[model samples]
Target chain A: MRQSRLVQASLFVFLAAMLTGCGSHVPLEDLTISLILGVDLDEKNNLVISESSPVFNQDAKQNIESYQLKAETVRDSRKYFDALATGEVTAAKIQVLLIGKRVLEHEDWFPVLDTVYRNPTFSLNTRVVVVDGPVSDVMFYVPPDKPQMPLHLKEVIDKNIDRTRAVISTLQVLHRQMYESGMTPSLSVIKKEKDVEFTGVVLLDKKGKYVDTIDAQNSAFLLILRDEKKQELTLTIPMTSLGEGGGIFHKNQISFDVSRVKTDVKTSYNKGKFDFKYQIAMTVNVAERLFPAGRVNQKELEKMIEKELKNRLEDMVKKFQANKIDPIGLGIHARAYQYEQYKKVKPHWDEAFAESNIDVSVDVRIKSMGAVN
Target chain B: MKMAKPTLTLPQYIFLIHGVQMGVGVLTLPRETAEAAGTDGWIGIVLSWVLATAASLIIIQVMKNYPKGTILDLLRHYFGKWIGIAGTILFSLYFGIMATVIFIREALFIQAWILPRTEVYILIALLSIPSYLIVRKNITILGRYSVLVFFMTVWMMIFFIIPLKQAQWLHLLPLLKEGWQPILDSVGTALFSFGGFEIAFFLYPFLQKKEKASMGIVIANTLTLFIYLIITIGAFVFFSPDEITIYNEPSIVMLKILEFRFIERLEIVFFAFYLFVISVTVLPLMYMTVYCTSQLAGEENHRRHLIWLLIIAFVYVVLVPPTFDQNKLLQRLIEQAGMVLAFAFPLCIWAYLLILRNIKRRGN
Candidate 1:
């Protein structure tokens, strides 16, 4: 009993010593919780950093305030940010990273993102988005209706991602794509218009340079072709065969809400050129019909929609080929399915993709008419 | 001439061996194996299991002759007193060095991922305190602690479900694309992760159910095999072949990618919880070192012997600062030495004992 007492006493001493030694360590109360960070290039080509942190003081009027500085590296920018702030700046709670279009125009954006992945303190699950203009405009632009800018941006991206309007582009996935030679990196694009708006997705070439932007309407088509659609996506297509009678609201337009999309891609090499065939089968519900009820036959409408969808998908692929970008990861499929053939053209896959022939076909079935005949 | 030693049951035997074998090495097993063999690292895991099981059987065969004594007694009987003393000294040094490697490796892991600002020596000091507490106890308590550690860590395997959904199965295709040489080389690397099974050498004499001893060790090896196979293959499918080679610890990297609604930076929490699992590895080896040292000194009490070894571990880290590269080099060197001690040394001893038994019986 005496020995046990001695052991307990000694253990208590050790615990006490450890706790007192850590007294000088930084606690949670003294940290500036960074919710959103932005990176952009200024007029003189210097690196610009901006951060928005929540104002927790009871007397403060606004919920969040923004800070900006010009520095060489990400780690270097923190010093300047700390001087103007009440507490030390930390990235542990960062939810979104906004990159400006000017910074991405250069081919050296990967190094700027290196600190986020390399620094042990930063979280890799932070969502990365590209801004169509200067990132500061979006970072400081807080709408009166939204709770906070960071939370608002995160919810917008998350909601649209589930609805198949934007791709899932977290920092982890971006790092993987940047390292992979088979697929190029792409990010959801947000623009600061009258208010905050998710314009579409921006595609980067193999060199990490911005290539082109696809609008929300075409973003859904692009996601389906890439096999990344998740939830309900509604697409409105213009029926060209019907006469153009209406001016603003076209009477020839029809809308379909796609519930399920399955895309299969096959690649083959014939002679010297590559050939890809995309077989897309979609089960959709008719959300709206503008054509006259007398001219609408179930089978005929399905055929017309299928042909129009096929043409839209073909046009999207043509745009990708014209830009010499493989955002949909077709090269990944080629490498997986045809290892031997893909090896020969692996060095310049973009040029090879530009010269290839891609076939797009859509098979649509209207499952429900939504309580309307 | 003797002290009263405790005996362990069949389940304790299984948990003891399992807990020891699956430790700090698992955090980097996928990266090490992938660097050796491209996509066929799983084959290396199977081969290492086969080799480890065969070695365990040999150790068991040698122990079956001596009912109440350990390898120290067997060595004294087969060889002379001086050689037995030398052998005991060598094994003690082996355990000491292994304990240092595991302690430093885990401390480095904690520094790299969890607490970046803390000094390595401070981490070492803090980790060693709990280790001293556990190693000071008797073998029965250690066995119970091992069983507890096993149950606490088994639930972490469920976290892999989130990352498995994004895995690309095509990365594992075209088996043997590089041939068997790389697979064979990786088996050499993987033998180190299975190193702790040699603790059976000390545990055999203390097993209560002698009839089921070998069965327990085999089950333990098979369990470690599946654990390693799941983690290694999970990393293989999740990362591209070229991308996996860049990471030092692929398993933690996989956990870093996991996101929860309320929790951020889950790998930090995992490493914190994994401190228990890492302690199980060092505690048993430290106790074994103290046991071997006490036998060498002809003293039955282990408390003084354990303190001296812990002091040496504490001083060793402060004296020779180990960089990440040096720590990696030490791990590889230890793996090679461990292969010889755990695999080759036992087969030779078992063969010699068999010949001795045959010669004596033939004369009779």
Candidate 2:
């Protein structure tokens, strides 16, 4: 037994020495982990793919390196990126994917993203950003005095999403929306200016074609209607109906932070159409009252805000019906309660939603008026 | 041959059965259930749990007639030596194939997710070490290892709650939208997941509290049902009803949505730790095959048989690493075999026992 222990110890040491291994591991610094990938159509309407990677070697002149090549597909472009980089380009760590608006204008463009989903190594949390201009512009946009563009773009979207200024669109969410017939997909939209700007969100039709865009202001109402409000939802409304004093400074607007919102979609079929009534109860802390406190009483101010918010919401729903895009996923509620009617129209849910009756009612609860009255 | 005393407590019996039932089925259970029944497959899971629990109670009832002997002894006494040998060969074949399928599937997952470049035979060899080391021990240590492994890995369920933040509860709505046909069909698939409950047949004789064994299997089946329900519902809510059917392993793929400030690929770590829980399923079934074979051979020792079994299993996996279509066919075959052995065989023996009693009473 003692001699067997000697043999066991030696065998253990030998096996650990040889086989306690990485199959074929690459050191982190040696591999090119592309942080951002972009796809666009050039002037000739050819598919152009690009990627940006952070350079780790100190000898490189710049902190980031990028490549742009016209390629037919995302998988086809990898070889080009591999050929250009010092190390093999790996996409498992991609943070942001930017699609040019030219690409979104075409139907069946979702296949461009098939590579990410088909490959298990690619992350599902990578943010899918829609570039309002050219993908190349945003891919090349490097502002001075900022961190890497990928990190900057990710933080900008995360910060904006927290404030309810933009929608959150990861690749996983996009896959669900693209396949879900009950509702069309929407993604966060960004534009290339002096710096990268998160403009708002773009709405896609069932076939994954761009229909229309929602600006930052409309996006807030859209999110509230969709029941996707984030931590801080501040809306600046012009109180024209209340006839507040147009002072020399012209402070005729009220800005309030929506602390809580409750939206219930009561669905029923009426007149051969689906009818949805949205009962919205918004709790807000009066952050800025542009009108003088003495001018209006608290109850009257609450009534004014409620009336204004109701009109805005109704108008937003009207736009949704006109565009025939149910980004708010009201069809989800319809299917939940009114299944029989919803299934028949499921193939063309947005059109059925367009013909439906949507009623918007707002019940405003004032949580607090800032430190003053 | 030296044997330890019959010393498995009620909790140990429950964990052993529960842990073994949770095998590689979880990796693809949601998609399998969804393939047949859509999101309403949760109902099928509950139905299978019922069937599995009934079958488990029947096993306990059969064993209660002969307290000191295992199922092998009961078989030989009731039907004589020839039938006893036949039953042994059948049980061994069933358990052996189930363990082999589980072994290959575990290796497939490790190769696909964690180490793609490593040859599968090497991974199979690496996995075999745990089975050999643990199965070589007595039943008491098996029970202890299960209870220990359960506590060590149960906290991993908390990671699932993060994805619930984006969960769309409506995906589960319109339940039974297509009617009852699909839900009933997927019960076969769910029964395969509930297959390893028959390990209780071997464990019944060792249980310290014999009466508590019935309640233990009931609780074990309930725990398995609870796990299946949470994982299925999580997958259902995370993916759209239509989208859930697209991925082969939505349960594992669903983990890709988890991200943190410090970690990006959290599923890699989750899969690494999950190997412990998966082993609780593989090891006990491996030990049961060896034990059942020895009981037939009239040997009190099974450790030597275990070594040969592992060697055969490793060679089989290395020789026939199944492709995608081949894997599906293999799983279907095993599902049918398990349904017969775990569900159908129990009631048959119980009825046989009743008939034997009736005949003896008439003669008297």
Candidate 3:
């Protein structure tokens, strides 16, 4: 009995020493989890980091507390946020990362988000958005009639992504885009004029510098070309100006909801450049037909829609080439199919892609016409 | 002096081998093969399955000669008593160092992901408790624990579905673009992950059906390969070619992208539960070490040796807490030693035994 007691005493002492090794565990309410992180450059090119965290305590008057400070990097700004916050600031639940347009103008501002990738606590699925004027405008904006900005921004982006109205540039996807030699990064731009509005996806160059903007109408085509069509991709295109309906309203636009889309890109190399043929097959149902009854036969109407859709897709591709950006990931196809030739111009694929031959042909099969007479 | 070891059923025996083969190596294997080879590293995994399966069969063949004796007794019979003692010590050292390697790796994983502030010695001590308690029991308990742990942790593979949903598939394109040389080079790295099958030296006599040892090991290697290939291909398609080598543990890090409405920070929950899976490796290796030491010292199977081994583990963790880079170096060196012991040693013994039997037959 004495020996066993002595052994138990020694074990207790050893465990006591180990108790000092680990840190204290704070409850979740004590942690000021940053829901939104914003990065932008000021007038003097100094980096500005902003954070907005939800106030969990009922005593706090406001639901959210926000702060902005000038810091060298995202990691260094945590101290500033902690100083102002009542609790320890953590970036574990950050939902949106808003990058200012001016910051994207610089060559190497993508590194400003180094901590998001380095810190394991930060989620990789957080959506990334580029704010067109100042990220501060969007970051600090609070709507009089909405949920928290962080939740609202995430909801909007997710909804738009499902509708194929915008592109999703989550941290994980952005990492792949930034490093992939074949394709460039594309993130939807948001601006706060009076309210937060999603201006289309901003195309960035190979170095993550701003290149061009693809509007909401065109981003759908971009998504389709990339074979990233989501649950609902509805398009309303003006087929012709043949006749105005018997009123002041002109009825020439036809709306359709795409049910399925299959895209195939065939790559070939010739004299000095590569040739890419985009064969797009879309199965769509006519949602709304704003035209006079029996103006044209169904076959003729199908032909008109195919020609118009083909023209629109071709125009979209031309716009991509004009900006020297391959946001649709044509370079990915080029790499997959033509490795030997793609390797030579991998570094400068944007320019080489600009000089390539792209052919687009669409085959739209009407699956159904809506219940309208 | 002792009763016979409770015989291990085929499934328990199979789980024992499979669980040990998939240790810390599975976490970083994607990055290892990617750096050595390209996205075509899946080929290396298949090649390794064949090589490891064949090597394990050679061990079964060598032990089949003396069906009743464990590997230590077989050594003492084939060679002199002094040589057998030396062989037993070397085996003990190898298995003991392997246990230490697994302990340090599990600590490193926990520290980097879950408990960055906790001292590694505490983590090592904590791990040693379970190992000590488990290793003191007989192989029957250990075998049962291994099979239970396998079922408990196998559901974690379903978490892999999220990454595959967003897979590029283009990343794995242009297969063999760098040629077969890189894949062949990566086979060396993949072979080390398949190292635990070498424990068959001690497990053969404990198995119920001695003839099924070959078939059991073959099935175990296939299970290990299936898990490795799923992770290897999943990571290959999920991460771009250039991005895979940046993180040390891309397999675990890739799980960070998983966002379920019900749970946040699933990887934390994952690593915590993963300790059980990792124990499947640690407990068995620790047992192998303690059993080897007691057999070599001509002592009874008692708790004293296990206690000494745990104390030694604590001191090693405190004095020379291996950082990630040191972990890599130690892992490489240990794996090379394993290759020699598991492969070359068995082949040489088989050759020597073959020549001896031929001469004896001629004389007869």
Candidate 4:
């Protein structure tokens, strides 16, 4: 009985010591987890930090606020925020990263991203975007009705990419493209307009430096060329059968309408050259037929549509070459097909790509006419 | 010395074999196989199963000739005392190294996933206690518990197929594009995953009915092959090939991606299941090590001797560093040694026995 009592006393003492050690490590109760982080470079080249979190009101409506801080470096920015804010500064809980245009152009973005990537708490799946103008201006521009706007940015980017070809880029995808050969990373760019609106996308080189932007029409072509998605497109072709230099049949005359398009890409290598054969099969609903307006034969209609698509596609490929970008990943396909040749020519691939020959083939099969027909 | 004890049934024997066969090696089998064979790694596992089945049958046939004696005793009978002592030492050393490898790997896995702050020595000590106690039990109870845990581990595998929806079928495309050399290399790596069949050579003496035990080994091999096939194919089909190459523990990573409404991380459940399987594997090996060592040392009370061996294993495991990379190196050495002792040595014994039998028949 005495031994049993002694054993129980010792066990209690050990438990007490453990509890005291744990008590010292206890964290504060009112800690807030930051969900989105934005960074920019100010005029003095100092790093500026902005964070967004969801806010709840007494009526249970959701609001959001963007916290701002400026310091000499990313680590110092966190220290500055900690001194001013109420909770701990943790990068692990951040789900979205936004960079200002000036910061992206002047400073090395990789060092800032490397800190996030190496942190164990941070997830690799966080969505990253670039904002135009100073990040502080965009961060401070909060809407009157809704405060939780960062979450909306993620949804808007995801939905737009899914619905059309605006292209939403995640951190993992960006890292892979930047690291791999013959590929460059691209991110959706947003700039605040009057009434809290955003526009445009900025392309970056392999090193994450700003390159160029494509407007709406060429952006649509870029989406189609990449085979992201195709909803409705307008094509113009001259009608050849009306008569020589006649109305609607004249050469260089425009006959265009909105139609559905589908494209397929195939790659092959022979001897010392590479070939990309594009087979574009499309079906057009006759919305407006200005030439031979009675009823056109399906064969003649298919041939004319095929010709028009081929010309436009060839022009688009030329534009991509002129811009020196391969969003279609033709270089990746080439390396995957002929890895040995790629290794030998990898250093000079940029020059080779600029000089490489491209072939385009379009086959348009018009399955159904529009309701007007 | 001639005492009667409870004996295990055929189903119980099969369960013990299956549980022992599927140990730490199965966790990394798919990644190792894929690294060698690319997309056709499943074929290498199938080929290994066929080869392991043939080798296991030969072992069973040899054991049937002397129903009351183990391989150690048979070696003593056929080749005399000195050679048998040497053979027994080699076998015991192999078991000891395998135990060390498994224990270190278990400690590293637990530290990384389950208890990050826990000391490696404390974890090793705690894990070794249950195995030491369970191994001291009679063989019949050990066999029964192995069956219980084997079924529990199989039930745990049902959660693995959840990631099938995310698999990229294009990664498996251009099949057989790399040719036959990679498949052969994969078969070499897969042979190590089929290591536990050699337990039959030592176990034949304890079986109640020797003839039935041979058939039990076949059933056990079939079941193990099926389980390995499911795990290997499931991992390949669920993860992209690039992802599989980076992860050492593919199954645990697969489980980490799964989240239920009630459960946050299913990998914790898997880690617990792995602990159970490791205990199940270690107990039988400790028992065999003690049994084989005492017989070779000419000791009377084998149970008393087992206590000392357990202490030695405890000290060794505690002193070793709990790192995944070091454990991988040790595992490679154990595998190379096992290939020679378990597979190649058995073929030699069978050939020698055949020669001896022919000489006696001719004299008669």
Candidate 5:
């Protein structure tokens, strides 16, 4: 019995040792936590990094926040942050990366982005945004009313890009677009206007350098062309009557409130010529009817709207050709359909894209008007 | 004291076979097959299963004819004592290599995913102690424990299948675009995935219902094949063929993408689930190794001798490759050893048995 007790004691001790060795933890005080970071380029063409986190009081309520630090590089920023913050700054918990306009415009942002991608702690799924003004200004924007302002910013950006009618791009998408052949990426562009600001999208070239800004209207068109998830976008079309008694022609703007939009792109190549067709099917709510009110001729109005939409869509396709930006990934379609042709013309795809013949067709089916007529 | 008699049913045998056959190498099977066959890896797996079934049948038939004898006893009966001892040593060495390879692979996975800072020696010690304790149990107890763990492992696969909605079915399309050469190459690599079916030779004598052993082997191979198909198709669909080739552990990486409302990293949950499966697999291999060792040594107190043998084996495994790359080289050597034991040895035994039967008929 005594020997059995000794054996049990030894087993218990062994178990304790094993458990202790396996279980390793980091204390909260020892961790350098970074909530958000904003990156931009200074006048010297060096990287400017700014990081921020909320300050908590003894009772666990957030108090006055700390000042943002500007460093020459991300590594220096971490060193500066480690001295200021209580613990070492861990990149694993970084929620968002905000890039300033100057940084986006800089010729070499790949090195900075590559560092983030290579870090084990930093996730490729983290949200990336381009700030129009100084990144520090955007970082320090804390509305007095909202305590969780950073989370609020994330929610607003995510809702605008994902659920609402705005273009959305993540780090993974950006990396794939920049690295993979036959594709270019676009990021949501944020412009700060003292109190009220507009957020749209900026297109990035294959090398990940900022190319040009897409206006809100063009951004909407680009979003539609890309077939990204969107809700309630307004499309204005100039109407022309094909037959007599077609809308009286005075109120020329036919407004379409797009409820549902689906687009299919087909590519066919024949004898060194690429034929591209974009088929758009959409459900629209007729916001206005300017024709005589006696009997609202549904077929005439539908024809007018369809004709106007086809014209506008053709113009949009022409604009995409002029800019040589295939937001719809037409090049991807071409490569998939005609591999041999694509290979022969692969080097001059951009020049070929500018000269490619793209045909646009719209088939709109009006589901219902509002409660009116 | 004599151990309690085991009442082995077909389902228990099926569970044991499934548990043993599915191990660390399976996670890399698709990529390995793809490397060998290009796009026809799935075909290789199907053909390998066919070969495995035939091999399993030969083993069952041989053991069923001698219901009270194991492979060791049968070897002694057919070949002389010296040859029997050598054959037993070869099998023990094969099992030892397999156990060592599995331990290293599990260590690398744990280090890469779960605990990057943890020492490799500590991980080996932790896994080996529990496995040694489990291996000390009788075969009946081991079988029963395997059944319990088998169900637990199956349920964990539900987490792996959650990413199926995002999978591209087109990646698996354009079938046979590369022709039959790749398919044959894939079959050679995938034959290793079906390695543990030969455990039937060791397990057949312990079964209470001897006739059911063949059915049990078929059922186990079928279940393992089904699981392999699900994970292979799932990985292929979720990742492009190029991406699948790049990932070291595609199944684990696929699991990493899945996020629940509560849990952020489902890979951790999978790692925990796989821990149970690994233990279940390691116990049988360790038991078989010790059993073969005792038989070769001609020891009466086999159980006591088994404890020391396991310790020595564990120490030997821990001392081999110091880094993950070197460990992979060791694993390749072990797989080559597995090919000889699993395929070549069984084919030789079956041919010998058939020739002996023919000679007896002529003499009669």
Candidate 6:
């Protein structure tokens, strides 16, 4: 028995050794790691697939190289790129996918992304951004200050998302909004004017077509309305409604850093209309003041800030209603809180939401007036 | 019979059954149940747990009549040689198909996620090596290995909470959106995931505390139910009702959303470690199939048959390339066969034993 055990051990080692040398093995150094992939539509309506990979070859001066190909699908571009590169194009490291404005304008951007969802090699955690222009611009554009464009772009989006300046739209989250009836898909939008800048977020309708873009200033408000506030959000409001100051200083602008924000959406169906009251409660610390600190009345200042915020949020809601979109997921609240009523409008929830009576009320509390006060 | 020893402790039985029941099915439990029952998938899990527990208890009852022998001996002792041979062949075939299905599924997952470049045949071969080594051992080690694996991998469930941060709890509302018909249809799919408990037909006779065997299986079923319920609910809340269907493996997709400061694509690491958990399912089933096959071959010891069974399984996996459609067909086949063998067969045997006991008492 002991002799037989020796033979078995040797045979096992032999097999392990032989198995390691089998087919379909790609070494790490031999792989071209794609950090970002871009999808766009060509002039002839063909699919344009672009990929940015960090150049690791010591001889190369550039840190990143991008390759673009016009193909029928994303998977087909890999074969074409393989011929141009020295290594196998591996997409498991894909950090971001940028969709061009032209593609987003098309009716079904979801079908173009079928490979990202269906292909096992694709990373579902890949952050998806909607480019305001052609995705090739963002994919190929390299900033002088940034070390690597792909890594820099990912960090930019990640930082904004953490600070609630941009919406968090991973491929998984995008898939959820695309599939959820009560919610429409939205992605962080980026524009390449001089440097890569986060322009805010682009809203997609139920069919995954772009509806409108929210600027960076209101994106925070949009996030607040969605109850997705992750970190401290500071908003500078122009308080024109507040009375003019008599001194040399003009207290026309007041900026406060929001320490705490709580938004509660109450949905009630009555008389064939869905009524939603969004109560936004915020506590803030005075960050900057155009007027002198001694003249500031904390109670009066809080009221002015509250009134301006409420009006702005009301306007934002009206914009959403006018655009016939629910990026804030009001339909989600309607579905959860009032399921019976929501069922009737499930087929055309955006239209129902557009006609719904939505009210916004902001209650701002000045937690601290800063050190001077 | 030299190695015939009743070494399986009560807790070991629970872990063994639990380990078996938790396999590739857990990975896709949400998508499967959601497809059938929509947001009400958790209901199907609860129903399947109850049914699996009942079926397991009946198998335990069947074993109570003959406390000293495996199901093979019981069949032979009750039905005489020829009929017993038929039953043994049938049981062995059931286990063989099950092990093959698990083998194919595991290799396919490995190829899909971790080693996209690795050939399925190579994965099957590499997977069988571990099964051969483990199945060659006694049941006590298998049980202990299972317990260790359970503890080691159970903490991975903590990752589910990461995605729960993004969860919209509202998705789970409007309970029974499609009504009872979908939930009931989903019960079949959920029951298929609970197929591993049928191993109790063989393990019951070897349980150290025979009376606690029923409760042990019940506890195992309940634990499986709880795990499935949490994962299914997590997926339901994490993905929208319509969105959850698009994911073939919702649990893995849920893991993909989690990004750590140091780690990127966490699902790759999770899938690598998950291989250990998947092994507990494949290893014991491999042992059972070999044991049953050797029993039918009139061998007192099943160790020699282990290598041959592994080869056949490897060849089978290589022969059947698991495309999406082919894998679906195989899963459906196994689910139907498991329902018959795991749920229905034991009840038939229990009834047969009842009638036999009544006739013998009346004759006396």
lDDT of 1 at A240: 72
Q: Each candidate's lDDT (Cα)?
A: 0.85, 0.87, 0.88, 0.68, 0.71, 0.86
- Which residue runs of candidate 1 sit more than 4 Å off their true CA positions? A1-15, A25-29, A241-246, A267-275, B1-4, B358-364
B1-364 per-residue lDDT for model 6 (tens digits): 3655748998889999999999889999999999998889889989989899999999999999988888888888888888888888888887777777777888888888887777788888777777877889878889998999999998998998788998889888778776899999999799988988988988988788898998899999998998899899999998888778877888998898777889878888999989988889988887888888888888767788888887886777667666756876877897798899888899999999999999999999
| TM-score order of candidates, top first | 3, 2, 1, 6, 5, 4
| Best candidate according to TM-score | 3
lDDT by residue for model 5 (A1-373), tens: 9997996799678768867333757777566556677788766767777776655448645542434556766766777777777656777656567888887776657667666754444654456778887877767776666555456666666677654345656564565455434556678777667632446778766556777777666677777666764645876655556334335564555566888888787778865678888888888887766544453366766766767777776887786678776555566666556656766776667667767888877778887766776
Instruction: Residues A221-247, candidate 2: write the lDDT tens digits.
Output: 988988889889999898777674466
Which structure is stronger by lDDT: 1 or 3?
3
TM-score of each: 0.94, 0.96, 0.97, 0.73, 0.85, 0.93
DockQ ranking from best candidate downward = 2, 3, 6, 1, 5, 4
Candidate 5 lDDT over residue span B284-314, tens digit each:
8777888888777776344665567556655
Ranking of all candidate structures by their lDDT, best first: 3, 2, 6, 1, 5, 4
Which of the numbered candidates is closest to the native, going by highest lDDT?
Answer: 3
* Chain B superposition TM-score per model: 0.97, 0.96, 0.97, 0.94, 0.94, 0.96
Candidate 5 chain A, run of 10 with poorest lDDT: A238-247
DockQ for each numbered candidate: 0.44, 0.69, 0.65, 0.15, 0.26, 0.61
Q: Relative to the unseen true structure, what is the C-alpha lDDT of residue A351 in candidate 1, on a scale of 0 to 100?
A: 87
Predicted model 2 interface RMSD: 1.8
C-alpha-based local distance difference test score of model 5 = 0.71
Candidate 4, superposed: residue stretches over 4 Å from native: A1-31, A37-93, A99-121, A132-144, A164-191, A194-265, A280-373, B1-22, B25-58, B67-70, B80-88, B129-190, B203-287, B290-321
TM-score of chain A of each: 0.94, 0.94, 0.95, 0.76, 0.82, 0.93
> Candidate 4 on B1-364: residue-level lDDT in tens?
5657557777778877777788888888889999998667878888888888888888887776676788988888878899889888988888777876786677777877676666666566566657767777667778888988887777877776775644434445445536778888898989888878788887777777777976898898888888888778878766555446656777665665555557655677678778988776777777777777887778755676667776675577667555778779888998899888667777887877889889999999
lDDT tens digits by residue: candidate 1, B215-258: 99999999999899889999988877767888777898888878
B-chain TM-score of model 5: 0.94
The better-scoring model by DockQ among 2 and 3 is 2
Candidate 1: RMSD over Cα atoms? 2.6
What lDDT score is found at residue A189 in candidate 1?
A: 94
lDDT of 2 at A203: 94
